[model samples]
Target: MKQDSFSGRATQGSFFEGLFVRSLQASGPFAEELRACGYDPHHPKAIYPIEVWNAALEVAWRRCYTGWTREAAYREMGRQLALGFLQTWMGKVVDMGLTMLGPDRLMARIPSLLALDTFRYELKVQPLGPHQYRVSIRNDPDAKPELIAGLLEAGLGRTGVKPTATVVMHREQDFDIDVTW
Candidate 1:
């Protein structure tokens, strides 16, 4: 038998921000779906399985993004989550004096950050140039490739990188994202 995309683990900080802080932006029906999935945005747990996060992402994508494609919606959700993360105490701690590293260096450190904040979906960033990078994600993949792309964009934007762009080549077992700023 085959497992689904939800067969992994997710962090309370990063993944929940994608749903509660960024996607839903309100209290109501979506809250019930999250509750049914064993998550309550009002009182969240420390870590949730990827299935719960995926459920929350689905509710957000369907509810908050009416006119957008699934991938686009997820990408925006990812972006919002990144932006939201920037405003948190942890984000402040992570960003404390780290901005001097600039976007490229920060991009390379994504693997460690993912390990800390996410349980599933691993990303490896390989620099192709001073301002260009090849990002590949393995393990249990969730959402579209653009979701991570959006995250990179948002993170890069904070580092004073002008015009961060991520182009997804295609969707295989992993996501190949070409990021440049």
Candidate 2:
């Protein structure tokens, strides 16, 4: 089978899939469907085909949140994922760093973290002004602006800054996020 546009390393995919499944399980329903989609939350380093993962997310979201739009659900999932990350050892380190250095410095570290995480896309961080930034993602066909926005918002929130993220551009190849606090 042809792979989907969005693919990540086994470790990255496992982390996300585990978080997604656990979040769904906590809310009740759709956990079985997620597993049926070929993801096992118990295995944290297994490889997942992005196509199956995407389909599973869609199915789980549709079943669990019949009234919510995909964008909204994804945004909320992203937010929860950010919170979930904070619960991990690396996430605790990141949280401590963000708390100490504040959002601007934290923003500067995002690209490195993303690279370390082995995400499918490349991240570029540009400063617009004090307390403002333009974040660009390249080679992202899935257009995950909501997820990016949510993560940024949560990161900023950690630094005691209420952030506002605007999707300046969202296309098949790239996306631009304008973040201000």
Candidate 3:
């Protein structure tokens, strides 16, 4: 079996569990599907496979976000995660520091930022313009591009950039997101 790679406070028994049920409610109806999957947000595992994480998102997409396109629903769920991040003291402190960097710099910092939560991935940001960037994720084809877009939209929005992030490429274990303010 492949080694599990995804981590960070969200995957481990930390901030994510606290915000998960609440985030589910905020994003849509309660996530009864999660419980059915043996994922009790209140007493979550210290670690689980990324496939389970994907399944949880799939549950949210199908059950909670009815009538929405798959990508749209994933994006909305990502935004909810960002909102949850902000409710934490650590996240609040991080946001205060992030506020100084604004969107452009923040986009470039994707790799380092993600390292705090995920692993076994390489992300690069190339500037297409002073206010535009192309973020490429390699080495983990299972990465969710649209969900990343939603995270960017919410995080960059905090800088008042009104940013837009679109998945422009996907081939095997690589994808790119084009981001602009």
Candidate 4:
């Protein structure tokens, strides 16, 4: 028999739990937004795919905290959670390439998705050395420095599976990001 690793178990939890905690009501504003974007709310379960959900995870990580200090790291977690939740929804909204609606309308919504408050932030990748990258971010001014860096390290290290990205946050903005992709 094969052994189930801790990382594998955690990933499973992130997805399954994320589905319920991440699902948008089919009868609420979210559903309407989906329809407007070419998604069928009545058949949401069938329309949304696992790949889209996975993509949400990708977007969320990018919005996570980063800083030269620890405080910034902890504060960024909150932003990450909030942004991740919304991206997960939008990813589901257009995951099927707007099959339920016209592609032009779908294309029009692309800017809207990018406009989703959570994704309004920017991320820049700078090569530190050869295989190393330095990720710097500009986020909420009230955020602490130490915690932000720690969180960036933890989040990126886990996401990239190489434990190698260095992150930093600037204490003068509301944007958060991951320097390592």
Q: After superposition on all CA atoms, how large is the RMSD of candidate 3?
A: 4.0
lDDT tens digits, residues 1-181, model 1? 1123354555564557544755456478877766776667677556766666666678778778988998898788778877776666667677664578787678778777655235556667888886888888775455367777777787777788774556666566576788887
Which residue pairs does candidate 1 place in steric collision?
none
TM-score of each: 0.83, 0.81, 0.81, 0.29
Question: In angstroms, how far off is 48's CA in candidate 4?
Answer: 20
lDDT tens digits by residue: candidate 2, 22-75: 455433346556556655555443445556656665775688668998878777
Model 1: lDDT of residue 154: 79
Candidate 2 residue spans exceeding 4 A from truth: 1-14, 26-29, 115-120
lDDT for position 99 in model 4: 47
Query: What are the clashing pairs of model 2?
Result: none
What C-alpha lDDT, on a 0 to 100 scale, does residue 118 get in candidate 1? Answer: 54
Stretches of candidate 1 above 4 Å error? 1-8, 22-24, 115-122
What is candidate 4's lDDT per residue for 1-181, written digit by digit as tens?
A: 1122222211222222223234322345544444443334354432333334333333333333222233443444433432333346443443344345432233234334322122234434445544445444444323333333443343333223343222334556533333333
Relative to the unseen true structure, what is the C-alpha lDDT of residue 140 in candidate 1, on a scale of 0 to 100? 40
Two-way TM-score contest, 1 vs 4, winner: 1
* Candidate 2 local Cα displacement, residue 156, angstroms: 1.5
Greater lDDT among 1 and 3 belongs to 3
